[model samples]
Target: MNRRDTILVADDVEINRAVLRSIFEEDYNVLEAENGEQALFLMRQYRDSIAIVLLDLIMPVRDGYEVMEEWQADPSLRGLPVAVITADDSVESEIRVFDLGASDIIGKPFEPHLVRRRIQNIVSLSQRHLDQDDCIREQARKLRESNAAVIDALSSIIEYRSAETGQHIKRIQLFTRVLLEDVAANCPDLGLDESHIAMIVSASSLHDIGKIAIPDAILNKPGRLIAEEFEVMKTHAVKGCEILSRLDRMGDRDYLK
Candidate 1:
């Protein structure tokens, strides 16, 4: 498998295109475009294959600014690296290109070796950023799984003590998720996204966590309790709050706080 990255050289001037093509041809596959329209066409067709773009600011059809604008409008094209090849070295031109998402700008009469190094550096940096993002996402996934396991274990201890079926916990989670989904869909003002809904559903499993503080006699009693016993049972909510507060302080857990 050929692992070489493809570089698109978009310039109206044939000599300029030839120079860049000759420079990078050994290390990369070169695609030439005489105008921005052709450049955009080739970009869309070989979007995954193209690694970076070398675009001329002044072109016959669309020009570099228009090309960058169109690229920015399309979400998928936004991440593709582009470097503007421009004769104008003014501060305004530099700012405009940067705002339009050009990774780098090569001034007119740029050294061949320097251009090669700059393009390579941008590609390397972009790859590093992408790798870091993947690492962060994987870490988040593992953290979520670990949190879920701890919650299930803690909830199960309370269930076992109270002689309640595991289905009781599952049902509460299910109901909470359903209601949250409904609210999210019908009430956009609530600002409940998928993450928020998932969090609330997971938290619903801990509603009976307070039962862990209640005496087994009161917790597992089949008959109605006397007023004094009932009042003691009512304290379970406050007890759960106290227990959670203590755990938060001890562990310094951000979510608990």
Candidate 2:
């Protein structure tokens, strides 16, 4: 991604296009479109590259109004800042541009310094918004990794305390991957995408987690358990649910039970 700012100047009048480019070219990579058709083509090709669009309302072959309409229909293009440059300086013209959701309006003939100032301010603000979104996404990724690590460590501790091998927890994770893959393949109704499947694999260690609390005599005895012992063994699922309920923000607890 080219993070440097780019400005697209779209005008039918060659002189007007040159003037706007001269004002912005020193600070930004400037692109020119002689007509609205060409403007739309450039915008599509370099939507992510461009930060601000300088649009001329009265251009030949699909005017600025139509270009605005096209970009506004698609979410990606809609967020880019658009400054309407118009020969018509009437209050009605400015109001219409505002109604069409332009970032700013410039009237011809423009002072180069004022044009420079407006583009600089708008591009700076747009860059800040993109930076904030990137920060939020990074924070979310770190949080998920931390939570997964805590689950893995705690589950391993549970397995060790029961005189069980770590392989017990490993098998739980492996079986969970199979079940989730089946859900992805055969059950569109479940709506379980890869992210949901990933959480399942991370948290499957908690499925037998409540076995940590059962008496060793009932849990590890080689012989058949009596009715009372079997009933006690059954309680591990409920105990697992109780453990989940005690935890903060573990999402849905029904899966544990």
Candidate 3:
């Protein structure tokens, strides 16, 4: 009952357009186009607000196929749902319309109730997909925030057990982000995108986590380490690797790994 969403009806015949309008005008704002060119014009003019297109396959000027071809070619318009309404019920016509990305096809002399139901279904399904995508993106964002919090906590623990401070972890993430962003800009072939950079910057916070396992005497040494103690300090790298190996087993927590 949301009259805000518009339905486009493109047909060369006046009676056909009038009949279709009567069926949908009660629930939706109907935009009528007597030719394909007019239909395309209306679509471009109100692309974002139009919920679904009821296209006639045999319209003049551009025709339905031409309109569909243009729609499919434009990435921005390709996702909008369309339904073909025509007298041509041939299998070839159906296959051609489907191939051109129509969501449904209704033969002419369509039952008013059936036509309305079919168009409603297509719009409803499309809206559901858009809603689901929004939900997924929200969940992913929350997951990323949770992962960052846990990483920061673990890094703080490592700093508490060693000579390092919280600023050290901050500096590591900052410097890693700077370098990765440079790589993304200059080395496009490497395919280092924003998400990749974020994951790597987060992982850098765990670089010295293995120090948590080293003895306090060696980990927080006041002076320079001796050769024997230096060897023990170097083992933190291997220890960090071991700790991370355990994280790999956490299902759907690849960010931790």
TM-scores of the candidates are 0.56, 0.60, 0.58
**Model 2 off-target regions past 4 Å?**
150-257
Candidate 3 per-residue lDDT, tens place, 1-257, comes to 22228899999999998999999988889999999899888888887778899999887789999999988876557657899998998999999999999999998897999998888899998888777866875676677776667677888898778646567888999999999999888876565768768788988888888887889999888999999999998999899888877766433364665
**Please, what are the lDDT tens digits per residue for candidate 1 over residues 75-184?**
55766789999899999999999999999999877699999999999888876766676676566556667677777788889778865647898889898999999998
Measured with C-alpha atoms, the lDDT of residue 105 in candidate 1 is 95
The C-alpha stretches of model 1 lying farther than 4 A from their native spots are 1-4, 147-257
Clashing pairs in 3: none
**Whole-model lDDT values for every prediction:** 0.83, 0.81, 0.84
Where model 3 places Cα greater than 4 Å from the true spot, the runs are 1-4, 147-257
Which lDDT tens digits does candidate 2 get at residues 118-228?
878888888888788667655655766766666777787687767664687788889889989997888755557776687678777787878877888988888999999
Q: Which number leads on TM-score?
A: 2
Q: Which candidate is the best by lDDT?
A: 3
Model 2 is weakest, by summed lDDT over 10 consecutive residues, at: 248-257
Which residue pairs show collisions in model 2?
none
Error (Å) of candidate 3 at residue 102 is: 1.3
Residue 223 accuracy (lDDT) in model 1: 99
